[model samples]
Target: MLIKKAVLDGIASGDIDLLFRTWDAERVHAGSTQRTAIGVLAVDAVEETDPAELTEEDARRGGYASLDALRHDAETRDGTLYRITLHLAGEDPRIALRAEIPRGRELTALRDRVLHMGDWAVPTLEMIAAQPGVRAPDLAAQAGREKRPFKASVRRLKELGLTESLAVGYRLSPRGKAVLSAVRRATASA
Candidate 1:
């Protein structure tokens, strides 16, 4: 549904090809070929519908309730999907009405211990920050953890809007960098 929202938001007035291409580019970047096909199908389902004429049913058949609903969800979201919307909107001025998704609530439990010598703190965030563009296995190795758990930690951070996925690896998001800085300061002071 988030994908559907992004696709709809990115679709210029009548430009199905442009929408498909944008979705394809994003999906390819994420390396989700299956998701790319799904997004393409959604776009195809409404290739003939103009943006202004888009109705509730059109949005549903496009896998959403309405453009309004999509906008609402996008507005409330603060993860990779929302970030992609921001990026696409920057790339194409025709994409409009994209609301910024602010960083989610702080992980209170993680505040003091974020950089402490622990299982899920210093290692995960430090490695990702130090090696912003490395693959998961390399990051895991550098962090002295295995591939599976390190990936899980990354996913957890992503769910908190603290990290983002790339085609090949992951990187701390703007929110991630801020939180990390705060964590460092807090830990140092402690």
Candidate 2:
């Protein structure tokens, strides 16, 4: 479930608590947390809601001025309407992970994980490090890989605090840089 940055901000500030999405099937469940640009969001509830059942209060909680505005926005998308209750959970853990440079055992573990990512890992990190903020499609093309899989690979790297997503592309996190440096040094020595 994609939440707009504005809505995310509203959630973070405790001004918004409801989200309406039209999806063929439920994409998120109660208790699931999503990490966003603002922070982490906790889904409190997911219920199938009839469009006619939505009230003005729901709209306000969803950051819309009126029920009509909420309905209009919801109708623009196709599928079953689900009312999702959410709150800002807290900070994204990866934010801290990004800043922490890996060392000793931590560095060894990170290096092992990267190595286990097969051949694409180090090169992908190197590519992003060299060309921060370049488009993903362009990066994928340069890497000679399909866009979707390339993005998935980047996401894996991100989960390890090895990459930071940008508006246009990606960059190495500080932790990522240290790990990459260590990997390269180990490879050179080997």
Query: Per-residue CA lDDT of candidate 1, range 1-190, in tens?
Result: 2445455443432322222111211343331222231222222221222234445554453345457864455445343221211122223211111121333454444454355436676568777888888999988887778999888878667655667777778777766677787778766877
Q: Could you give candidate 2's per-residue lDDT for residues 1-190 as a string of tens digits?
A: 7788888888878889999999999999999999889888899999999998999999999999889999998888899999999888888999899999989999998998897888999899999999999999999999999999999999999999889988899999999999999998888989
- Candidate 1 ranges beyond 4 A from true positions: 1-118
lDDT for 65 in candidate 2 is 83
How does model 2 score by TM-score?
0.93
Show the lowest summed lDDT stretch of 10 residues, model 1: 91-100
Among these predictions, the greatest TM-score belongs to 2
Model 2, residue 131: displacement in angstroms? Answer: 1.7
- What's the lDDT for candidate 1? 0.51
Residue 140 miss distance in model 1 (angstroms): 0.9
Residue 69, candidate 1: alpha-carbon lDDT: 66
